[model samples]
Target: MTTMTPPVTPPVTALNALGFDRPAADTRVVVAMSGGVDSSVVAAMLAREGFDVIGVTLQLYDHGAALGRKGACCAGRDIHDARAVAARMGFPHYVLDYESRFRESVIDDFADQYLAGATPVPCVRCNQRVKFRDLLATARELGADCLATGHYVRRIIGARGPELHQAADPARDQSYFLFATTPEQLGYLRFPLGGVATKAETRAMAAGFGLDVADKPDSQDICFVPQGGYAAVIEKLRPGAAEPGEIVHLDGRVLGAHRGVIHYTVGQRRGLNLGGGDPLHVLRLEPESRRVIVGPRAALGVARLRVAEVNWLGDGAFADAPPGGWRAQARVRSTRPPAPARVLPEGADTA
Candidate 1:
C-alpha cells in the first residue's frame, strides 16, 4: 500500500499567516551574511521593512589558500558579494576575523572526534561556539537587540519559554543542526528565512532585490573541505591516524584490512572488502587493538546512549531535584528526530 505524503508549505506564507511581524524602524538587527542568496534576501527584507540593519560576515577560514582560486561564496568572492549587497541595500557592513576561533573550536573538535572513533557534528559546535554564542555576543556589544541568520528553523516563545520548531519548509528545516542552542541563545536569535519554503523562492526574492548572489548555487560541502572530501584534512592534521588496520569479524576471525579507523563510522556498509557472503556492517572500532569489528546489520540498533556535555534548555530539568526526572524530546544527532526521553542528571562531566 502506498502512503500519502504531507503537503509542503513555504516558510514565507506560513510565517506571515502565523502573524510574525517585522520590527519597527528604531529596532536594530545584525544579519550574518555568508554571501549566500538566503542571507542576502534576509538583509534586504529587513532593510526594506525599515529596521536598522547591519550586515556582518565571519571570516572563519583562509578560503583563498584552501580553495586555490577563491571564487566561491564561502570565502573571498562571498565577502565581496556581501559588501556589495550591503552597499546596494544601504546597510552598514563589517567583516569579523574569526579564523583562529573557528580553527580551535570547529577544526580541532572535528579531528578530535575522528581520533576518538566517534562522528562529530562540527556544524552544531560551530553554531554553539561561533555563530550563536560569539556572534550574538558581538551583536550585543554593538548594541543590537537581535541577531539573524538564514537558517530554516522557527523560534517560538510560549508559556513554557522558547521552543524550536521545524521550519514550514520541511525539506529545508535546519532544526536538527540547531539542537545545541540553549534557551538563552534562542531568545536573541532570529531566522528570517525559517519561513521560506524552497531555494527557488529565495532566489526569486534575491533577484527581485537585484542581489549579486541571486543565481549562486548552494554550497554542498563543508566550508573547510574545499575539495568536498575530508580525508585529506584528517591526514594533514593527524599524520598517522589513517594507517592500515585489520578488519575482523564479530566472532574474532580475521577478515581483511581496512585503510584506517578514521575512514569508517557507525552503521557503514560500503567499502568493506570481506569476501562476499551476507553483507557486513561496521559494528565497532577497536582503536587499541587497531582492529575493525564487522558484523550483520542487527548489531547496529542502540536503544540507549550516554551523551556528555549536556546543555539543558529548562531550569532544573537535569538537576537532582526532580522526582521522576525531566521528560522531553532528546536528539543525539541533529538530523535525527528528537526521541522521547527521561533526563536525569548524570553529574557535570557524565551527563
Candidate 2:
C-alpha cells in the first residue's frame, strides 16, 4: 500500500502550422481541390509538410455537359486535373457526386432569385451551401481534423475564436464571397493560400512541387454557368423565365419593350436601344409586374437600404446591437472598397 502507484505523466501538446496540437503526420487534413493551380498548390504544400492530406473534389453538375467547358471548377476536365495532382503529390483523392445537392441548393435558388427580380451570386451560394457545409461535413465523416481550401481569405485566431480576415493580397482577396462562413465552420477551416502575395507565387509553389496544374488557367465565372450566359442557364432551368415585358421610364412613360426582366440588372445603362436620348440606367426590376423600370443615373442613388440574412462574425450575439445601430464598414460590391456605415439590427437575421 505504501508503494502504491507511479504518478501518471501527461503528454505535451504543441501547436502545429495548422494550430492543431499534434505532429503534421498525426493531423489529418481534407483539402477541397477545385482542380486549379490555387488548390493544387495547397494540397502539395501540405503533403510536403508530411501531413496526412486527402483531396476531395465535388462534381456539382453534369460532367457530360461540362466535358469541354473551360474556366470552370468541378467540371470533367477539372476533376481529371485534380486527380492528377493528387497522384503526383502521393495523397488519396476522391470525387463526390453532388449534382442533386447543387441543383437544390445553388442552381434552383439562382433561377428562382432571377425570377424574383433579384441578382444572385451563385458562387457565394455554392461556397456557403456546398463546399463549406456539405464537403466540410464529409471531411469530418472521414475523420479529418480540419478542412483546407485555396480560398484567398485568412482565418486569424482571435481571443474570441477564429476570425475571418481579408487575404494579404488585396488583388486576389476573396473575403467578400466568403462572408457567409459561420463561426463553427471557421473553427474547422484552414486557408493555406491566404497569405500568398500573388497568383504567380501560387503557381511557383505548384511548379516547385512538380505538380502539372502549375500552368493551368484559373477558374472564371460561375462553375455551373457555361459561356458566361446567365440568361440561357436560367431559361433552361426554368422555362419561359425570359418573358417579354415593357421597359418603362421613371415618369410613367413606356420607353421600350425588353425581352425579359432577367436580361437587365439594376444599374444597367447599355443595350436599352431607346434610340438617342438621355442615358438611362436600370433603377430596379419589378418581376411581378413584368416591368423593367429605368431612369436617369441619379435615381439609382440611395442613402440607406435594408439588408437581409445578416451573418454576424463580430463579438457577442447579433441582438446586442444598440438601438442607434453599430458602426461598421459596408461593402456593396466585392470589387468596391468598404465604405463607412451604421448597421441597425432589424431582427436576428435582418439588418
lDDT tens readout by residue for model 1, 1-351? 999999987566322321345435667889999888888999998898778899999999888665444434458888888999999999999999999999999999998788778888788899989999899999999988789888989987777677788898887888878877988888888887877778789999999999878988786667887665676788888898887889998988899898888888878899887776999999988777778899999988787667687766565545663766677787666557778987666786344
| Residue-level lDDT tens digits of model 2 in 99-168 | 8999999999999999999989888999899999999999999999999999999999998999999999
Error of 1 at 210 (Å): 1.8
Predicted structure 2, TM vs. truth: 0.95
Clashing pairs in 2: none
Best by lDDT: 2
- How many clashing pairs per prediction, in order? 2, 0
Superposed Cα RMSD, model 2: 2.7
lDDT value, residue 277 of candidate 2: 76
What does the lDDT read for residue 106 in candidate 2? Answer: 97
| TM-score, per-candidate, Cα-based | 0.86, 0.95
